[model samples]
Target: MARPRAFDEGEVLDAALRCFWTRGYEATSVRDLASSMGLTGASLYNAFGDKRALYEKVLERYASHSMAERIRRLEAPDIAPRDAISSFFRETLERALDDPEMKGCFVVNAAVEMGPHDPELRAAALASLGEVEAFLTRRIEAGRADGTIQNRETAQELARMLLGVHLGLRVLARLRPGRELLEGVVKPALAALDPHVPG
Candidate 1:
């Protein structure tokens, strides 16, 4: 029979996410993952196959883990989707401020590092954006029907613009004067999303 796995999968993957989140996929070596997880290089290979395999798992964990929870919070029934989406950006800003490490975002980081010329990685990054945008579009459409938001734009277009704000905000968060600069970006974003626009 095959030997049982030695390490806790969840703990190790979370560590990998943090490492990847901090250093990015290409910068993290197999030795780095092994040392960080208290595993030998061979053990890591046996458990996760290779660096790309491990990085893929890290991306999966990032989605199903706390990231999904954030989406859940935003889509929760108790909060209006419009309000919840606004709070999501503000909350992310707070999270960035609270963490002195300046990790930015996992998906945004991946988008920068691997988005171009890599079909698989680009597709994966785009799928995540699609998920968020679809969710936003649904809510925005609902809002439009209920007289909450103006129906000037299609749901799909509005969703894409909202996602653009997130992408831009993550990039801005990595800079030196991040928060104040982000506030400028965020405020204009809020105004653009406002339902009542005087003609």
Candidate 2:
């Protein structure tokens, strides 16, 4: 019979997440995860399979808490699509500003760091990013139909450009974290959504 696990799964996973978030996948070792997660190496392996497997779990948790949660909240039926989109960027900007460690974003970091070498991680990263793009495309289409956003471009094109802007914001936040600079970067992109604004 298997022994019952004593440690809290969520707590240990959060610890592992912080360790990976700080050092990233390639730099983080199993010993580091074990130490941070308060588990023996054998216990960690038994419970989480392997380092790669644990990291995959961490990515899923991150998406649920960050992107998935944000989409759920901002896409409420009562919320205007344009307002929802604005609120999403506003919250992202605020998070970047408030992060003293300037961690940027976990998914974006993973995409850049491990996407080139690891096919599984690359697919996972792209899938996570695709969720954001799909959400943006939906909101833009809604906004256009309601006459709140310009129709100068198709929803797909606009969403792709905004997705690029979102990626740029996350990457730049790590390096600069200056309010004016980051806001300057996002302002034009948001402005382009205005129905009255020239394309």
Candidate 3:
């Protein structure tokens, strides 16, 4: 019988995710992944299939791992809709400010870097965005029903707008990476959603 693999698959995927997150898909060579994951090139191939395959797993892992917390916060039953939306953006900005490389979001970066050329990545990116948009749409609909949100726009419309803002913030973070700058960008966007505060 063949011997079992020695390394932890989860650990290897996490390391690969970080490598791709930092260096990007095109820039990160197979050797880079192998080194980062502390595995030989042959081992990486044997385990993950190929560099592209590893990246696909990394994207899935990122959706489940890095993006899960935000989705959880947005989906919390007890949290107010406006607060949930605000806190989500605030947390994203906070994390971006704390990041030394200011790499922004991995999904957003991947969307820009590989989206046009790669159908698979584009679909994955869209699926990831759809998850967030769905959560936002639900939250916005709930807020409208409760009269906490302004209810000026349809939930779907508002969700798309907020999603755009979130994506923009991520892009801006890559260039500015300042708390104040990110806050400046997010505050007005959130403020516009407030019924009490005149637009």
- Return the top candidate by TM-score: 2
* lDDT to native, each model: 0.78, 0.92, 0.87
How do the residues 142-174 of candidate 3 rate in per-residue lDDT, one tens digit apiece? Answer: 888888888567889989999999999999999
By summed lDDT, which 10 consecutive residues of candidate 1 come out lowest?
A: 190-199
Candidate 1 vs 3: which has more TM-score: 3
TM-score of 3: 0.95
Kindly report which residue stretches of model 3 are placed more than 4 angstroms away from their true locations once superposed.
none
Among residues 3 or more apart in sequence or in different chains, the pairs in candidate 1 whose N, CA or C atoms overlap within 3 Å are none
Q: Supply the TM-score for candidate 2.
A: 0.97
Local error of candidate 1 at 21, Å? 1.5
In what order do the candidates fall by lDDT, top score first?
Answer: 2, 3, 1
lDDT per residue (tens digit) for residues 100-190 in model 1: 8888878778878988866787777777767777777877887677667674778788788888987888777887536788788878776
